[model samples]
Target: MSQDLQYWKQLKEKNDASAIKYFYDQYIKLLYKYGYHFCQDATLVEDCVQDLFLRLWEKRSSLGDTDNVKLYLMVSLKRSIYEKLKKNSKTTVTEEVPEDTFDVTFTMEEQIISSETDQITKDKLLECLETLSGRQKEVIYLRFYNGFTPEEVSEIMQISNQSVRNVQASALKKMRNNMDDPLLILVVGKLIESFFHEI
Candidate 1:
């Protein structure tokens, strides 16, 4: 197993505090960012993230081992937020909860040095992203931003693998149509350059 995978094993087998801290340090920002995508309310996301780690720690002994710790955490956090929202809201049925909850906003970093042309390109990228549907955006974020496979994304979003591919294809096509240079979409995610070519 990789060293990264060992941390999870350590936590599960030994109840190691360092392993917990390692996971916290590695994933807190990502978890918070991902949590916010589901619920715009920062406090609820923050609380859910905190409670997630607490629950993980408390239940470490019974926790199963996994090669994909990040995915495990993401799945756990998603369910935690859903349960919390279900409890807080009057909507008793799962189907009654709004499906249009995924939201993503892309912005250029202030410190990145860029030319006038670069700025315009980034502006157009943001506009293109805004035009995508929520499911499309979520698929793009998972596939490109987080570098998850379509199979993994299906697990995360609770959709079929074919649905993941279809959503991503539609999203990429929309972005390609709106973009002046398709390569410029790399600003959004690490896998964009390669995935752009694949589609």
Candidate 2:
């Protein structure tokens, strides 16, 4: 293990609150960024990040050996988002929003065009996600959006670790095969490309 991993392990072993806080401070922004990509709502992403860190801290005693803390955070965020989505689906939106409480702004033609393009790209990605089998979609979401190791995912999903890896590999292959729409593929490709660049 690298020095950082060794440091984290020692801190983890000690169950130090400062170490946990340090970990959260270090990775929260990255987690929020990834969460925003999955949720597309700033407030929702903020809530998810806070909840994820809270859970991580609470479960720190039982946390497994993780060489990559960032990956662990990512996986936690992914699972949280999925749970949020599922819960929201089952809940009724009965809360009323006052018209005056909302701000409506007019956009310039260029801004409007850009907004439309972004929506189009997001729609295409959602469509691609929908094309996946339920299990495949779950695995892909956990792997890419959450950054979970296959073993972690398997433990959570109650499947074999190899099965998690297989599902992820198969999902990516199928997504690539189904990328017949050049524009959509280009958009998705750019998004994935940007992720690597940021890393």
**TM-score against truth, every candidate:** 0.83, 0.47
Name the lDDT value of residue 36 in candidate 1. Answer: 93
lDDT of each: 0.79, 0.62
Write one digit per residue (lDDT tens) for candidate 2, span 56-129. Answer: 66776787887776666766776677667656665545642221111111122331123456766655555566
Q: Tell me the TM-score of model 1.
A: 0.83
Clashing pairs in 2: 74-146, 75-146
- lDDT of model 2 at position 175: 61
